[model samples]
Target: MEYFALTNAWLIPLMPAIAFVLIGLFFKRWSALSACIAVFASAVSFILAIFAAIAVIGSGISVDAPFVGHVIWAEAADLHFEMGMLIDPLSVMMLFVVSLVSLLVQIYSIGYMRGDKSFGRFFAYISLFSASMLGLNISANFLQMYIFWELVGLCSYLLIGFYYQRIAAREAAKKAFITTRIGDFGLLIGILLLQTVFGTVDFLELRQLLPSYIASYGTGTLTIIGILLFIGPIGKSGQFPLHVWLPDAMEGPAPVSALIHAATMVVAGVYLVARAYFLFASVPALLEFIAWLGAFTAFFGASIAISQREIKRILAYSTISQLGYMMLALGVGSLTASLFHLFTHAFFKALLFLCAGAVMHAMNDEADIFKMGGLRKKIPIVFITMTIGVLAISGVPPFAGFFSKDEILSAALSVNTPIYIIAVITAFMTAFYMARLLFVVFFGEKTNMRLHHISCFMQIPLVLLAVLSLVSGLGGYIYDFGYWIRFGAPQPEHMDISIAVLSAVLPLLAFILAWNIYVRKKWSADCIAARMGVLYTISFHKYYIDEFYAVLCRFFIDGIGRVMYFIDIYIIGGIINVISGLVLFSSTLLGKIQTGQTQRYAAAFLCGVIILLLCGILYFNKISGITAGGGVL
Candidate 1:
């Protein structure tokens, strides 16, 4: 029975990979069945993950499967790589969240992706992504974890560019892969350095080894390594400076937006930081830097999300901002709170994305909030689910997001007062923008260019995710799961009633303001832009961050790549050709002497032997430094 538990964890991830492989290999024959199989496999995996999480919680980390199955993956001096499963409280929770959201997204995709030619490919990629993420969660060591991490990134790239024919989608995918690759490079170096310093890569062993290792390296080396490792979180988590790819990622399908952008791929960074908490704790300066980076990202992302008219773009920025909150939690040394926020954010964010998908489906794939209005009545389930998600994300009471978000804010406050203040402002901005999006899209008079209806499959996931958004937080309180496990027990941590009230009040106020401006007063954003002038220009242009990145990339990566390409084609190739020609000429000269004449060959051999004997005698006699004649003779 215990073995069944171990087998189930591996099998849950394996089934999806199997489905993806089969669908990809036999696309023509298995295209139609792939969607159903993908959905079924994800659902089964989600159920298994839930059961596993419960069983792990019940048993309370009694069985640590250090390596359920281990195989030598690589070997070098002082470095050995093995692959296996590592089931801990953290991984169990992540597995459940990822699987659950994946299942719902896949189910929704059935209706949303219908009639699309690449439907099978879409589901296949989703299944592959789910399996990879689960594998990453349960990986036993850094090497295996890196493998799966890269796999998930690959899947994200594929899904983000699912519409490969679209230029914007292709560009976005390229940007995402390239940007994350830079982070991955840093992570790879950090892992190698850890392995070089500590002789073992196992998580438990490394946790024990790192303290002594840090003592030896001193503070400076530790901080450098910590900061280097933190680069990975910046890229994957959409932190400041490396966050340009996430917004463009909205070019993918809406279901993809729900799964990769909202639920799974983006959260992997926070998980990595939490996984390496022991190492991070040693470097307080690094942690503070991370905290400030997260704070700035949270504030910046929310500000950009506020002015976006495209529905998916708004959600994209929201995901970035929410990810910043999670990073902030980790930065504040509140790993449990960060993980809690991740759990709650997954549900509501997925719900919001799915509801947005439903709206897009209903409006004939229209995603502009400016063009959509009065959709609340047309898509009642979507409206209800979206409202739940919006409120939850806004940190309204009793919702999943409120508890986790409040915990993060409290943790930030405990760490630094200024960061806490910044976080609250970000929270207020989050509430305002979300409410603005909700009002402009769901309220007002009908302005849709086309009309359609959402299918039951799409609506069902929306409703289910909405329920999760509303109720998931209670799990931490009732079952003693999630953050409660780390906190030991749920105790009020000096709640600031004024800050909480301000956080809660601002969203409603934003909603009311948006209603007056966009709904009741019928003021268009463009009209406001005309009145505000430069403020509108800055908001509309997203403060020129994208343009800045473009200029930087063009001057560095593209320019350097072009020079390298030219060198490779002309100078390097010419050198190789010249070397090849000389080798050929030498070969030809040597071959001419290998004629089938025994007399000629014998003459040449005798001459060569004479020359060798003469040279050896001369060198021994003339170049000798010792008195060989007196000592040996």
Candidate 2:
């Protein structure tokens, strides 16, 4: 089983990779076949992942003694690099999540994306997306992981901009790509620093050597490295100040959103931090900073989500908020809680996004929640499933989100009081926004929008994910999630009665508030907005964060661009002109001297000879003194 885990695990990524190539090559004309190939690849990967996970579990592999195998990829003087596979508790868990979700997304896409012009290409891109993340999850070293990381970004770029015909889609893809690259730059610096100082990027080897880096270089070095590494997550996970691209990412198809937000691109950041928890844990100050940053991002995202009218955009901001929640757990030094949230969030978020996709399908991609009304009886399944998703995300009792979100809150309160307060506030805002979205979209005044039939392909994944959302967190708790998916030390059973009650009660209160405002019209939303004034306006405009970024771009990026342009057109160009003028002027004088005649050349030579002879006779003889010797002359 161990050997099978090692040898056969590579197939998990390879299958989807091959599907990408095959669909791009031979299946372009057949959309159905293309989807079939992609889904089959992902299904095989899922099955293989299950078997591999079983092997790891049955073999009793622990974190400290994770099953790892490597073949030397390259060698140089005093250095060795290896192509490696690591089967640890974390990787195995990610394997199951990624493959399962990827498979379902592809299946869902068959119906959602049917009859689209670029359907084959869409499947191919998503296939590569899955393959890249699968590869990233099992990577044994930072080098391999980084390679897959960039691939994941590339897939997101392609998938997010799937409809290249739309200006918004194209720009969103570019924005998502470039924004993440900024964070990736910092992550690359951290990796290089680790390699330069420790001479290795292998996770296990680095784990053994990090203490020496501290002993020799002090905690300051780890602080820099940890922060640098975390910058990548901040960008990937849509944390504040770098989070403007996420809501815009709704330009793509619904399945793309589900795939990217729930299981792939965004999750990469939190997963990286969890995978490299040792570096962060070694630096207490960095961890604290991370916790605070996460707290603010959560608040920021949820605040924006409350005001968003677009179905997918609201979900997009919610994803950012949930990612912030995960990062908060990590920042608070509870990897188990963070990962547990990650696990549960995967299902519910995907379910939510897929349900939104269903609504879009039924309404011809109409995004405004205000335009959607009386959908409860129109699409009963989506309404019910989306309600479950909303409740799960709101941390309502017995839902997957309640268990995992409670754990994160518990983790935060035990560590920092201020952070805990921010987190609680964020949680309330989360519930309010989600409930508001529900009431506004499904139960508001009926609109004139036409509805289409949602196919079984889309509904199946929603049902499955909704089930996961309902029970995954409880299952994680029952199975002792902390025992395997943890860092520093094994986590003990923990649930503060007060915190749990707050977690449960606050969301319900927010739900009731949303009900009164949007459902029963007991409270006036516009009046509340009028009362809040600037605060409401700021949130409605997404806190003007994107505008702020645009301002910064105008001031700095565009400023630098103008400088470079001036140099190119004037400074550098003027110098070149000056040199050219000099060369031309000199050539013109020489051209005049040439005259194109032998007689003129002879006359000039004679004049030059006479002048030299006179100078020689006068100056040369005087300098020679007594004798005007020919030799002296």
List, residue by residue over 6-38, the lDDT tens digit for candidate 2: 567989999999999999999978988898899
- List runs of model 1 lying over 4 Å from the truth: 27-32, 62-79, 448-450, 478-496, 522-532, 561-633
Instruction: Name every residue pair that clashes in candidate 2.
Output: none
What RMSD does each model have against the real structure?
5.5, 2.7
> Model 2, residue 122: displacement in angstroms?
0.3
Query: TM-score of predicted model 1?
Result: 0.87
**Lowest lDDT 10-residue stretch of candidate 2:** 624-633
Report lDDT (Cα) of residue 47, candidate 2: 93
Residue 498 of model 2, lDDT score: 90
lDDT of each: 0.82, 0.90
